[model samples]
Target chain A: MPNCDKVTALVSASLDHSLPLHKRLAVRLHFLICVWCQRYLTQVRFLREAVREHPERLESAESPSSTALSPGARERIGQALRDDRR
Target chain B: MAGNLSDPQTWLEQHGDYLYRCAMLRVRDATVAEEMVQETFLAALQAKDRFAGQSSERSWLVGIMKHKVVDHFRKSVREQPVSDVELMNDEFTGLFDKDGHWKIETTGPKEWMDPSSALDKAQFWQVLRRCLDGLPPRTSRVFALREIDDMPSEEICAAMKLTKSNLWVMLHRARTHLRSCLEQNYQGLTT
Candidate 1:
């Protein structure tokens, strides 16, 4: 059986769809009975999903900033725009 | 938030929040992100005369913000000397034996209690962002380009001047770090 390190690396690499056929088979074969690896894979998958759904993007023109813009920064931007127009 | 682009003050009020969020995710710094958004607005205002009715106003502004983010990264990578030693650590080495066999201590991942529910919380995203910020700048940038932005690997390599192997290594390390961070920080999500 491949070590946990090898399986873990391969599993993470597979997320990019970069593993070859034989290596894919090796990963699959390892997962068949390796409960620990399966759990690890689940953790990685959950992290990916959570990251994708994170409210960091400007979801739409309507969605406001997830974090409030600091007043100082807001003032700075305002001042910069005013100067540019002058 | 989509309307006339004539007023810069209105742009700052309506689109400022959204553009700030966009830049924050890419740069992971409030001051820098705010500056980038400010720069984006300046660029947009300057180019508004040339802004043919091609894309939406927000989209056009975002395109400029993306360029600003890329420029920030390029400058950051050039200014800071990232060490290779940190990238090639023996941290995960103990998980296996010399023969590359899983050691008895290498217990597999623990079942997450309720990952999706945890993700639904607003604080969960804050933690995730913090974890991402904790990553090395170059690694975080590559991960963002590939995962968050969904840029193609070929394009990432070309744009970042990274070889395929180097890109893969960066991604692997980023994933590894994020996974560990999430597991440690979030309840019901253990590795």
Candidate 2:
């Protein structure tokens, strides 16, 4: 339980990128000292990068136009479009 | 509540691809993804005045799309719900073995590096996609919400019905797993 509490403190800062400069400085210093935290930072960095890249190439791999929409569905959207104009 | 968002052509030109890409990552079906994107736009159009411009228009649109995805998942109940996922919790227990025993030290502030051209190219995305697809469905969904959706962890806890501790546990686990997978699979220089 105590350990969990310790991790909780770190989690928000990690997510927010909002640690105070000194604290941020301390974390970087620790990353330099600790292999585990260094690896942990690396993981955080990679996961963030992965998420950013997901949208870039998603359309090319799966083209929406290549999949056929039902005529009825198309008409509903078409009607919705017309209604929006009115 | 209605303005530029009411302008169909202007809205599409501004947000079409952004919404489409966000929707595709979650739904994984192009047609359904397109519908989700369209639905997001329409919903935003209806709620335009609520846009306080607090977050980027991209984040705002993705936030709506995320709720729609959550609803879709809840209704579909796919093969497994998040509770059914018996993820390995022991893996990261060491880092938090004792509260305040070992504080994280971030001194040098490791400079962020752009992935090399080779990694930025097709092979990188392929390796990454494969790794993401390899994650358990629930973990992947949580990871996507936190990382891809760019929603705050607190917001994720509320949306996913998870406690902050549980969310962190899952988040740490997911980040650790992704790190290992990307490092093992992709030849990223930093990883």
Candidate 3:
């Protein structure tokens, strides 16, 4: 029987790639008794879905000035673009 | 309308900020993100003839920026040797005991009721951004590449020069930390 710590790691790994059968069974069996690990799996899955589905949410939540291009960068890039044309 | 391109002069004023933010989220560096945004625009300008107008100009620029960001990572990975110290440190040791069960008192997963609803709120996204910011730079970078950029694990391994196992461990650590951080911080926003 794998411990909760091992099972949680497996659960996280399952997201990136499919787990081997024995390890998958171990995680499933552990989840049968351990509600905490179940919550862990759910939360991680939710985190992935939320982040993946709504990346633009970060843009909306962020203050514009913080992530925006600085005036200097804007000027430099603009000059580079103009220079490329001429 | 075959050769029509959106005016390049209006690009900086219109799409510059949005492109910069997209680059920042993936690269996580102000200067590098700026450079990437600049490169993306220049590359787009040179390749203007290739634009089929199949997608909106913003989406077209975003597609180019994605390639630019990946190229940046590939080049950086080649130039600098990867330090595995952070990845190998097992930062979660305190969360588990010798018996390998969760410590529970301080580290067990908390139940987050209505987790999906939290996503609809602007505050929840803000908390998530902060949690992502809290991760070690390498961990967050790996997480962003995997989740945000939707890159494959094998590709990530090849680009970062990490073994498959090392990539798994880094992602596991990132997900665990982000899960806990969001549970603790965003729970307040929900209630």
Candidate 4:
């Protein structure tokens, strides 16, 4: 019997499609009785879906998001690419 | 000719910002992301004849950016930090009880309240991106490469110079953190 610790770990790997068939079966069996692990699995899947749907925001100086890149950096890269063209 | 592949200025105007965002999400640094996008443009220009009119112009550029992202990680392979292992262990321990079972009441699933709709909303993605950013940089990179880019495990291991187990462990920790973060932060937004 795969314990909850191993089962939860397997749930994560399962998302990556990395788990083997037997372990996957074991996880499925574990999930039968473990509502908590099942919920954990759902949460992970939800996170994955939410992320996949997250539109990639273009880097902007005024955007407060951490994903923003500096305008100077963008200009420097554009300049480098232009130089490469010449 | 059919697409904007031949025009550098148009490519920069159309896809530069988008490519920069993709690269930035994976590499998590301003300077590095900038370099990767520039490299992608140069590579796209050099391989213009091979464009084949297959994928979208943005995807073709993104394909090149993916390679640049891998190459950047390949060049900077550092010793796996001890803190990573410690953090993984801590996250694991927190999720399971001593008997290797969930602490039940605390871990029960609450109503996600129209999960699909919440997922479709832009606000949910903003929160999701913020949650991803909160993860440790290395872990976030691995998760983004594997989940976001859909990069193969073998390629991720080879490019990042990670052992299979290490990659699995890091991915597990990343998922655990992301799940909890979403639950805490976005539960209110759902439904």
DockQ of predicted candidate 3: 0.66
DockQ for every prediction shown: 0.40, 0.21, 0.66, 0.47
Off by over 4 Å in 2: A1-37, A49-86, B1-21, B27-35, B44-119, B188-191
Candidate 3 Cα misplacement greater than 4 A, ranges: A63-66, B1-5, B79-85, B88-91, B188-190
Tens digit of per-residue lDDT, candidate 2, span A1-86: 22222333364347744656766566656555455555456557655865566655532333333323345555555566557757
Per-candidate Cα lDDT values, in order, are: 0.71, 0.58, 0.82, 0.73
Q: On a 0 to 100 scale, what is the lDDT of residue B175 in model 1?
A: 79
TM-score of each: 0.75, 0.55, 0.90, 0.83
Best by lDDT: 3
lDDT digits (tens) for residues A44-82 of candidate 4: 887666555453532221124344446786677678777
Residue range with the least summed lDDT across 10 consecutive positions in model 3 chain A: A58-67
User: Which is the better candidate, 2 or 3, if ranked by DockQ?
Assistant: 3
Weakest 10 consecutive residues of candidate 4 chain B by summed lDDT:
B79-88
Ranking by DockQ: 3, 4, 1, 2
- Error (Å) of candidate 3 at residue B20 is 1.7
Model 1: CA > 4 A from native: A55-75, B1-7, B13-21, B28-34, B46-63, B71-82, B85-90, B94-107
Scored by DockQ, the top model is 3
Lowest-sum lDDT 10-residue window in model 4 chain A: A57-66
lDDT for each residue of candidate 2 in B130-154, tens digit (9 for 90 to 100): 6665556556667777777677877
- Candidate 3 CAPRI category: medium
Task: Kindly indicate the candidate among 1 and 4 with the higher DockQ.
Answer: 4
> Model 1 TM-score?
0.75
Q: Which stretches of candidate 4 lie over 4 Å from their true place?
A: A16-25, A49-68, B79-82, B85-92, B188-191
